[model samples]
Target: MEALGTTSLGERSPWQDLPSELLGLVLQRVPSHAGRVRLRAVCRPWRDGARLQPPLPPLLPLLLQRDGTFLSLPDGTVHRIPVPDGVSCLMSTGTGSMLFLGHGDGRCSLLNPFCRDTTTPQYVDADCFGFQIPSGDPIVHNVRKVVIMSDHIITIQKTFEGYNCALSIRRRGQSTTTVDVRWMPHVAAYSFDAELFQEKLHIILSTHVGTIDLYVMDLIKDDNVSLQCILSTPVDNLFLPFGHIVDRYLVSSGDQLLLVKQDICKLYNKLMSAQFEVFEATDLSNGHAQWRKVDTLMGRALFLSAGCSMSLPASDRYAGAREDCIYFLCELGCYGIRKENLSFGIYDLRKGTLLSLPSETMVAQQGPQIASWLFPSNT
Candidate 1:
């Protein structure tokens, strides 16, 4: 106890010697992942304490840039990662600094890029890479997004004319068990994306007839699963002029689920301008779920993309976070790598304005336009 307050006989007490119990309390109050990383940089004791206790809200995710490089987050430092040949990072999985790697031959692996000992953790054959799907249907699947949990991998697949969107759930060390719930919607309906929110998985399906349906799936005990319709809301008429396009994204934020709509206007596929509308669910659990518009997201910010969409606190500008912002991908033309074509920006919800990523980050490196946000798992 005295050591915490008093220095050594002839020298000052260093931060490296701070008690683990005391350090953990400080870590919990850290508002951003980058803040924790700075604390870990102090000394071995601080680093060990970070790994042992595991800070709050997990670590800030690394931005996987186009050219197989990693943007060191808030700082925006670029790192070239030599991923295994023929394998690509599918997304971030597990806990800390780990990634889900997809092999060219159709297999998956889990890797922690920070470590040298790389061992493939899990495997899903490319045969379907589709969660041990039964060999009966002959439809080419388009997976919207995959949520990888500790014990379960839930994939939300796209819908086709005759085939309904399928949610494939596969667990580890078990017989090929799957939660195969095929939702048959209108042939004209388009599946936007899926989100794992509030212990349940939900997929958004927007019909051409001006309606949005939220299909919520609950994975229950005894391997039982059930589907519920939470938000089946109608959209206002957007009697639009030519060259206007709208895309909706479903994101799970803090304690609420947000439905973000991106309105893009273009001429001859050239960039014009865009806007975002944010909405919150009123009666999320009740059968009659509804969405109400929210001008500000309190102090939280969102990162939106096709591969992954998530919400994180933006309370700490010192840790490189901005409040009430939506970071989105906007490739002017077909998703491409052309310097002039790669258009990305951060939309300030509070100000109702858009801001581009730093100019340095924009021209640093470019690869496949398909980039992903990764929150690593140490486990």
Candidate 2:
């Protein structure tokens, strides 16, 4: 023990000679998070391993920032990412890639973190409509936005100031490849894109009669981009089942989609209906659509809402309790939750077995944004 602190005999510390992996393992096992941060500053080997950015792993947890910052947070630290300037819209499609919307020009950029590359889809021509064929045909799909629909790809419908709107799909992996799939002429007047299932891409349409219609595209076409609305359960006044639930209760964990819905049964007791769903990346290639409610999630409540709000930092600075979590201001107040849990939760989706977090500690907020790392483990 004295040898670690000894300086007289001119003896070198044995830890200096340890393998890189061993040092990393030792660092990982440290209990105090602050200690780990200090250790990284002690040597070059430690710093590299701690801050390495490998290929974006499948199902990697992500945090969507309001100020055009979309990040892959593993331990509660922020890896500053350079995004396209003037991007006003951002959505994490849960595919280690983000769908971004830019201002000035209504252009779409599909960014893949794993590949560290960007695909700028072709621009939409005014007064015309186009769609992409999944058959290696590439067209810049400049609909309202772009979404990966299971085996198919769907773009939001777009409209020009003086022209009609259309949809298009750009081929994958090749530059300048695009195919248009406009299945029906003037179908439903207009349609908005949404993630229906973990893998299934859907279109939400409003008919002339004011009835909202939902059409689930058939993924089995030669072009692999076709639509057939899901029948039996027609769209009604309660057209927004998911939106309504999110307005009340929903929380998303890393790859776990939580929904907490409130219902009044019998004569008047409000019951919280919680559904826990997990999205597995393997399912995308195996025909297992987007998200599936994991039956085991059925249980009790974890958190009760005062209210929830989406908060962003005034500047580019980002901080959080743990690497996987971030601190941002909401209308309700400041709180902590893993960054990946932002999308689906009790407040966003009325579902999931409730359980209190392990600890409740005070964290500082910086101009409506709270930036900090998680407390290290106790072991």
Candidate 3:
């Protein structure tokens, strides 16, 4: 009996006889989503194998800006996807959606550009939220940062009086409750950055006196949510002279919380350099916590920006991703003297090396725009 596809020469394509198990393995190793899509189009057998394979984790976070343009880092490709109409300013971004603030009317809404879903418009009075409209400031000015979680929205704003950190909680079939953290002592001179972890809120504040403080607050229905101080450490003398110019970020990875500190120094008019340090929460059992300096992330990669911070494994399957490395999209210009220049790069923890994105891959923009690391949803 003759075997399948066996002719006089006894030659056949190896891919034609590839087993399903091996095909599945190949599909799993395909790093980029575009590659996976192309693999499915190769042939019927490969398509079937692709369908059987599990969803692949994101290789690199996409850089999304307020202008409805995004750059995919894997291939340095830029694509434009318009946001909802009347969205003049981008406020925050979440799982698969973005929060937008209107131009002159203080209108706010949530938009999922990929899904084309826009929530009902809600009027927002920035003054009521502790933001003063300085004589000629932009409508959405003075907002340092914003974070949107499952059931809450947090904002850090600078007002005429001082800095204000507000948390707005929303629940199904209930009116939203707004809570302020102004009651916390020594908050006036500091700017805050917050992240939601394990159903609670973790915040890090950088004070004018070159001190860093960490606070944990519980989410409650009432207005009196308790805020507890977790850690307070004075920054080194190098940062003491800069005061509030230093940047601090709080990120939660697995069961631990990480504090990333970036110290910026001005070299000249527009040139600047930065150094980074990472600390991890070592003791959090039984409601007690302590922070310790961490040298590495143990094969994990961190993505950080103004919106939020995320951590994922730096698997060997994904090229260009290194363990104990951080991919940051933040500003790195001279503090208080000139406008911040938005930058992106990878910071290696093991080698203490800072690698900037290739110039050709960066968007040609003159001013700072809303940029963050976005994980594309499979759906």
Local error of candidate 2 at residue 41 (angstroms): 10
Order of models, best TM-score first:
3, 1, 2
Which one is best on lDDT?
1
lDDT leaderboard ranking: 1, 3, 2
In lDDT terms, how accurate is model 1? 0.61
What lDDT tens digits, residue by residue, belong to model 1 across residues 310-346?
Answer: 8878744344347888877643442223444544567
| Candidate 2 error regions (>4 Å) | 1-13, 16-60, 70-80, 99-103, 112-145, 148-153, 157-168, 173-179, 183-224, 228-231, 234-295, 298-379
Q: For every model shown, what is its TM-score relative to the native structure?
A: 0.74, 0.43, 0.77
RMSD of each: 6.2, 12.0, 6.3
lDDT of 3 by residue, 249-311 (tens): 888777778988765554332222556789997665556676788989877888777765678
What RMSD value applies to candidate 3? 6.3
Q: Model 1, which residues run further than 4 Å from truth? A: 1-42, 46-60, 92-98, 114-122, 131-141, 158-166, 173-188, 220-224, 237-241, 266-272, 331-340, 363-366, 376-379
Residue-wise C-alpha lDDT for candidate 2, range 1-379, written one tens digit per residue: 3335335786665555557667656665543334455676665545665565332111212344433332333343334456566443344432323443433234445565433567544543322223222232222223344455434444555453323334454344333334545543254433233444444544444443434344455555445666654421222344444423312222333333333223212222112233323222223344343433443322221222212211111111222222212222121212222232222222222333332222211111122122211111121
Model 3's alpha-carbon lDDT is: 0.60
Instruction: Name the best candidate (by TM-score).
Output: 3
